[model samples]
Target: MKIKFFRTIWWKLLVSYLCLILITTVISYILTTATFRTIRIKERQMEIEIRVERIARIIGELCKEDEKIENIKGNFNEIARISGIPLQMLNPEGKVVAFSRSSHPKFRQIKNINLQPFEMRKLREGKKFSYTQYYGENRKKLYYYICPIYREGNFKGSLVTAVPLGLSRGFAIMLLNSVLIATIIAFILAVFLSRSFTRPIRRMGEAAQSMAHGDFTKKMKLSRKDELGFLADAFDEMSSQLKRNIESRMKLMGDISHDLSTPLTTIQAIAEAICDGVIDTEEGRKKYLESILNQTRRLSFLINDITELSKFEAGEVKINKTLFDVVEPIQRAVESAGFLAGKKEIQIEISIEDEKLQALGDMEKILKAIQNLINNAVQHNPPGTKIRISATKEKEKVLFSVEDNGQGIPEEEIENIFNRFHKVDKARTSGASRSGLGLAIVEEILKAHGEEISVTSSQQGSRFFFYLPYLDPASADVFLDK
Candidate 1:
């Protein structure tokens, strides 16, 4: 399926960062531009007021020297040329006395300008007034400053100065260009940072998709020392486990078919021979039927073992708990298997550190597990071999082991002995217990009790051992009746 640009993590991250940068740039531009304009306006206003006030004081001093019109015009023209401010002198009655030719044409065209009532009052009170206006075709800004000239507390005339806005349009243009450049830089950096953060997420999504399609061999190879790295490691572990499970399942099916077919094939042939009267004697027919019965029993045993192992693996078996002396079940299993051992003249013995060593677990399952181990030992051993069953206390638990003086398992097969349907080919043909689920079931029972079983073997013998938790002494009172 095609993914939309907006839905992908990389695209989303890039867009989000771009939006944030654009917003910040806009806000920064607005604030900075406003502040700069404000400062420029304030500076222009102050310069106009100071220059006009100084001219007013100079005009007052000149009025004291000579009241000649020609003299005042000359002085005003000189001051305008030097200060770069357009100047005009006005009589107290609001008539223009002198005007600088340096002033804008619009200003020279005005013969007289009456001040507002409030403005005139301010001038009469020996104060100055300032205002701004736009003039000319280009609508350039202009600042007007007016102050009353005084000679020894006597008002002589008003001094007026006009100053054009000092700041040029070029400065604003430069500031705008600067903001644009900053925005571009910020956007580039945003893309880089966003990509760095979202790259891992993109890889994870791809890996997940691959896994969904039953591809367990793919692995995520992130090297970051963060949560993402940990997630990658966990994903690899899960993939490996899944692969093992699939392989084991396939192998189990094949083993089941091969093992089950052997007995059925034998039974079919033997029964067909008897039915066809191929055995000429009645005794031969009876022996053939007995052989068929043995095969039938073997098939039943195999099926039962498979079913029970499945229950144990699925956690469906409920253990009935009780407190019992550990020796009792071990002794019981030995007694049950003694008849078979006697046929081979093998002597089975039992040893205990304490006969009364008690454990908490399912009694029936424990007895069955012990019997399977003893039967295995008897089947594998030569005639006159000695089998020993021992139980001893080990701190808070009891250790039980079955040891046999028989040809030991090879090192390579030891690890797989407890795997379901795992059979030693040599041991099977040597007339050892052929059903391969015995040790597997025993391991499952131990696992259900939260214990583990181990084996140690050499050419001389093999020993299988496991630990069972001892019944707590303080809780023994509760089970005194049993």
Candidate 2:
């Protein structure tokens, strides 16, 4: 269970944060306690040293006045009483002479004393020194200091001072309690912060699950300015894209069904009419058969275009690139689409500012794109309309255009003209069997070639144009001569 708990990021983060705070608090407690003990001991030692030196000085002055140890013992006892600190006087032979307890109000007898070897050595050296010792079953600790007494350069005795080790227990306890309380508060804050941080990620995970189940409506509600915030933004963008793709695909399916059914229904009706002998004349029958064929061809064209466009969108179509005369394919497209123009008595005009302009691209796809544009122009224009095809070398690229003197596209509708299944109003496309995929396919093909197609239309006419990279302008004369 502990292992499993640690495996979760929430628990891990909480534990990590808590551990960090706990370690810091523990270290601080140790340092604070140690420092307090050091400062308190030093203050106590300083007070003890002053008291001991005063007693030693008094004893030395009395001895100089010819006062014996027994005579000065009473004076030492009185000095210890006034100082309010436990003190002992040891003879030169290490025998106790006087004690502060002897003069205490509760006990009027002298207290016994024992000196360790190191302590005796410190006294003999007449050096002031301090040390800690523990006594009794509970090991109550005490800080002891020794100050030496001397008269006429002869060691007289030592005055010792003792103080309980704990001088500020109340302050120490308060500080410890404060640190512990702060640590607890920090742990609580860690829990809340970790949860807050991971909440958005958890929500995002659930949202992703919903998306996987075909529900893109669940969105994360997070507004933080961090890496996590950026991740949330990306997740929302992905959800939006998924929703759009699904909706657009559904609409495309419906459009495909309607478009397919229209041709199929026409073919079926024509076949039924011919089979039932509704058309008596053989010429009429032939016309009906041709109509069926045309419908079938139209159906085939739509399906093929749809399939090819899907491949192009999916990045599955490979372009075969080669350097070719830009005019060659445009010229071919003109001649092929000329018949369609001739049907409506539309004259096709061609122009080339640089006849030697060569471009690098897939010739077949480029030809198909040019033919699509020319067909679109021919179908939309009225009889006796003029459609102009022109190519010119501009800087490092060759600009190709197809302009038609027909009813132009509206400014508002221009942006979506290249969208699949998008068609202008029927008034602009009368008598044209437009699957509405021609311009879209052209756009995709040109895009695959690292190019773009755009349009500008107004009251006079509509011009569709794009640029292709030139194959080396310096070799223009060589290509022109070819």
Candidate 3:
């Protein structure tokens, strides 16, 4: 169970989220603790300074009474009581003159030392003093402040008040506990938040992995209307398109194989007949060989068409943006279709409102695309059927259409006529000299250059229309097939 959980993305996401929350919480706790500790120390120092100043006023007046050493000792007791802390006054000779607990015998033995930096500066200026960290006779830590007791603004003995930071230490410990508790809470929240944030991304990753494994059925479905949502929608669209392309390619392969197989099978029979001494005339052998060569050439053309379509799709075939006469490429396609028209006894008619209209695109590919449409109309029509070619410029776009007065496309299947390998009748399609990829190739080539190709038909005839973005005559390539 543990191994399975570890292998899954959702579990991994949850664990990672928890870890992030804990890390953030720990950082916050540390920062808060440090800030609180600094505040506490500053407050303790201020309290000690105030106590020292209060005691100094009484000591300076009493220390001047040369007759009352014992009275001064009693005054120190009063100082300790009022200050709410230990009070000790040191003389210039490093002897304790007045202090709480002065009767401890070691108090007289404990030696006074030079004042710390803050204390010495205060003493030199005859002002109140402060010490941030001080040590006592018993090696106890204290926060202290001192002041010079004075008369008539004259320097005298120093008065010091100290506070054992036992309470402050306890407060610090309490703060640490509070910080730890808060950190734990924050860690939990961070984990939850991080998991929530990463859930969509993780799903996307899974979807991508699935696609890599050739499963393009699932879509990334994120409900958020942010950038993630847009990404999810794009991913879904990509998957669907990928699936469709795969299906189309598979269908094309099947159709092409079926078409090629027939000719190949016939060639094998003809070869077997020649080996078995069935054909005696040189002309009959020549005809059989020519038929095989024709089929081979047809296969080559189909392969070339597929390759060119892929190039167009990949944008490897650059659209040569030239403003030339649209009539030029149209005439080229019409000329190419003439041979097929002649064979079928089909009369192709052409009409144009403006022959000088131009469009921006690759002329070669455009001509090929146009040729495919015209050839299709000519090939499928009855020998006497009239095929029409028309071109017009509309709103800065050029529309070229090939119409045929032949067996019209069925209403049900016209929509899919341009699909590769799709046949109105597979048996009829098989006998046809060309592969069924003609219109499919044309459609793809047009789409690659950001052009539009569509088919509309009625009971009378079918019209195939394609539009290309127009270019000004100044920029168009002028290819006149004179």
TM-score of each: 0.81, 0.86, 0.63
Q: How large an RMSD does model 2 have?
A: 4.5
Q: Name the TM-score of candidate 1.
A: 0.81
Model 1 spans with C-alpha error above 4 angstroms: 4-6, 9-15, 50-64, 68-71, 74-88, 92-113, 116-144, 147-156, 161-174, 180-203, 425-433, 472-474, 477-482
lDDT of 1 by residue, 1-482 (tens): 45787787778888988888889988998888888877898898888788888888887787753464345677777876887777788877656788777886656656376677787778888988777888888887777778898877887778887667745689888988999998899888888888887777777777778878988767887887899789888888888898899899999988888778988898889878878878989898889888888787788888888899999878899998778888889989989998889999989999997767888889889998899899888887678888999988888888889999898888999998888887776446423246788999999998898888889999998999998878776787676556
What does candidate 2 score on TM? 0.86
User: What digit string (tens of lDDT, one per residue) describes model 2 on residues 176-223?
Assistant: 889989998998999999998878877888899899999988987578
lDDT of 3 by residue, 116-228 (tens): 56655567478765544545565655555667766556666677665554335677688778867876786677667656776787788889889999999778877889998
Highest TM-score: give the candidate number.
Answer: 2
User: After superposition, which runs of candidate 2 have C-alpha atoms over 4 Å from their true positions?
Assistant: 1-7, 58-64, 72-75, 102-143, 149-156, 164-172, 427-433, 473-482
lDDT of each model, Cα atoms only?
0.82, 0.81, 0.72
Compare candidates 2 and 3 on TM-score and give the better one: 2
Task: List clash counts for every candidate, in order.
Answer: 0, 0, 7
Q: Considering summed lDDT, which 10 consecutive residues are worst modelled in model 3?
A: 102-111
RMSD for all candidates, in order, please. 4.3, 4.5, 7.6
